[model samples]
Target: MKKMNKAEIQLLHNSIQAEAIEAMQKISEADSVWRCAYEKAPDELPPQEETEKLALLHHDFMTALTLLAVLEKTMPRNSTRESLLILSYEMFKLTCPNTFERFGCEDILKSVATLLDSIPTPEMLTAGSIDKSVHMIAKAAQYLPKIPIVPKEETPTAATVTVAKDKGKEVNINVGLHAAFAPIVPRLTVFDLSVMQAAASIYASGSKTFSTNQLYRVLTGADAHTRITSKATLEAVRKSLDTLQATIITIDAEQQAALGKYRRYDWNETTFKGYLLPMTKIETAYYSGNQLTAKCDCWRIIDTPPLLAYSKTIKQVATIPQKVKRLPRGVSATVNNICIRDTLLYYIQLNRDKGAKLNYSTLFEAAGVDTSDRISRHRMRKAVKALLQHWQEIGFIADQTDVIESSKNDTIYIS
Candidate 1:
């Protein structure tokens, strides 16, 4: 290995630093993204454009770290070695936070410092130099010195649902507005809900049956670039409509539709006026998906199933804005949006107490996923945090609207 004095050491460090100059330039972009998100509201997340930029920032950070993890074997150790190690560790910690936290960083860093000590003058450290620390962090995180979790005393509350120690056990769903429609049908998604909401909007205009075009327009905002539907957006609309029109709500949605079927029949000559209200099943809908004439492709919502079950039409619910239709994919994400929208509407339906904290189970019920048991408590906790962050990003909810997952009560306070 070649030895170096102060001039040689500084020259090498500068050259290496020049190689990763992009990281130096873009590393701090996360702060700007964070500011943009929090500027409007603490819960706000970046809009689509900013979201793309955030991805680019992370990509740059990862790219830089990939290049910097190793020391060229031919270069001898000098005073700058610790600086190199510290730079790599700091960048790894910031860019790979989940990995960092999972590894339990402090112990991992110490172990890394120890390992580097024995390696002698740079025989070329591999990428594993950082990964070695990652491995140590992972082990430290997995089997950390155990600290027993003392259970908090259970407190009596007015929440109507039963409270039992979860014990990491999946129990039958135990919360909802009615036993009939307990869980949201499994296949149903935001696409389905968006279609249903749009159809509900049309109900007032005396449109007994709505065309597919109406749904497409509402869902896609008549693209400023062109009026013709994009293939992807049209396909989404087709699937959503097909999903709703498919004579049977899948068992998953049926549980959610259970709430839909439970609505009492109101026969007012003044309102429904002898119009048949079919109740064999809560959203007993059927329609033609075959491309007939563009004008002829339409749907009859069989019966107005609970379009998210707030005892009001979609128009009556707190509007979440059509912009959210562009929100990224995932069934859970779609459900999260509905749950937040329902929180606003839920209070009105029952005249909920202002101070009462809404429990996680009830949110699951509102999302129509109460009985699905697909989403776990940990994921729900993450969803809550993301939900709040997005709200803060968009200024959708108040700053004071905080969550209470800190206790056994696992609840949300939507002020």
Candidate 2:
């Protein structure tokens, strides 16, 4: 790949800025529509007729924000482009305070600004450098709001099981196991999850190594179901892994405790403290034909502390009759879009037995979502609906009678 010229880079930056401006304008318009629809009640859902429009507006805003985040990386340090990017970010916050609050964008914006201020100007960015940063930013953008503030709670000592009704049949949902105890890590996109799953599978099979092509097949679902023949898709998956490795996740104090007994520490506590990537390391090899030949020494779960705790927690609950459903290839492809995939999986894992009743508000609280916010509620509803649809498509829930029952009082029962 060739390096991007200054002109080309500036063009990209301008395009991103234009999109950001448009997103801010649309958000302002949407606020007016929202007020008209809900009489200034930000906590109330818009009428059914206007819901789709509102959702589209939200989507546009997020897409633009994502692009803007990428542009942050492409610009030179202390340049006019950087100043404009900062202005756009501040404008979004000022124009859409509620939106920012709902999505928890304040800390992220502050951190990005700090990072921009510290970066020294680079003479020239290579193609590899630009691609890697773009990939990392794109992946990071999807997960910004998903990180939950850890609550004060004692470490769990035993599994807690609850019973619920599904079609008048009794079902068991375990709440006190390692699955529920695992510390919250950075929210992972579907591709990230798929890569982790692939690594887990490889580790489970008594192997510590896999090729990039092998991972590509697993991610696209071709390895488990269909045959993946397209080189383009494979190349895309390879690129995604490169991006995935660049993404970092921070672990909390509780999470650190969970892993303290397992691994010996070598990195610095202050600078490297609590910060780790999902994959410990990834290396790819290319051929003379510019094709990816192999990937080696990719480590996860066992290698990463937080993942180790999470994996251990899952194992502790292995005795549960109905295990957490695995994502099928078709479902895995779009899992990133469902912002609450982790929460949804937790619900399913705990309530997979017959006649399971899950409280909607409780699940939302567990997922660190504020149900009081109308937009957050709306996103949760859509995420749950998408999760169920995907579960059925992947045959995780085969019976048409197995439905999610929602009450007017905000409770969800799984039957």
Candidate 3:
């Protein structure tokens, strides 16, 4: 054994630190790449699947790689990298030998060590040099002595499904694959009611028979996106009902309208129909001809967290626009627009209180306005159209004139 001088030790430390720096940079880059691949690329992979597990695995691998690199850099160059690499390999061998087979190699280990050894070291007599040296040497010594290789756990063989026809029976009822291969049918999240509703509705509509995959896609759809839970496909489906149950806060027409603006299309009757109706599972619906009819039983979607948490964040945002002078006073102005805007707001408030089933006369009475004046009715109609146009402009209203007309009073219900 040879003892090195202070200068030689310092040179070794600098080299090792360089190696650590390189390893950290590479691991970070790899982490980002894996994330992008997981999130952005849909190539040949299931869209509805959650890639979180793979992401976490990638993260852990990178983290371990980083720690090893740092340990190598801080330790002496002679055997520091080799020892860390050995420890990593041994750990993988114990826990996941098959996974280690994919990426673990002598060259990679050696390179990792070399990279850690290349970082620049501070001049001697700086803060805590002796402590750092002692720590590095101790760490290197600790890992160098033993390299563990974990015994492989026996993986269960794939379960087989058998189908046999009952003797002397004309009919053959379908049997579940899980019934035959119970152990292999990976545990799924509990079934969710909302997902059940969506599935039931889909099934009723006579769309092709539902599969776990199709259901997954539907749950991932815009209407059900927030309701999905769990990483396992089956488990996520099972949890769909619970997620839907929790979604008590119904998404209002305004939010629906906001969601619609992201997609472009002509204002046709079909799309208008979709915008007017609430989701299919609702028990009953009513007719409203002119004014928008919002369902009062609108369900909740997300859990309402404390307002203060959000309010502080909002306050932090710059409010310079609020201080800006009104649109140069004459950019736009009209009595019809103003009156109609006020009227719409009035009607909205009244409808909110009165429920979606309110008739035009009832609404007018609620607003303290006369329902009989022909001229007033004409003005109101014009105002309604203008309000619709404004809602359209701001992407805050879907098809505004989707009126379910009332036969008794010849009034329109804006659904």
TM-score of 1: 0.32
Model 3 alpha-carbon drift over 4 Å, by segment: 1-15, 18-22, 25-34, 37-99, 112-415
List, in order, the clash count of every candidate structure: 23, 4, 39
Q: How do the residues 258-372 of candidate 1 rate in per-residue lDDT, one tens digit apiece?
A: 2333223231111111011112111211221232211223343333443222223212243335443222222232334444443333342233245345777776654544444
Instruction: List per-prediction Cα lDDT, in the order shown.
Output: 0.39, 0.42, 0.32
Tell me, by TM-score, which candidate is best.
2
Selected candidate, larger TM-score, 2 vs 3? 2
lDDT of 1: 0.39
Residue-by-residue lDDT tens digits, candidate 3, 6-42 = 3333333333333334445545766566667657765
RMSD of 3: 27.2
TM-score of 3: 0.18
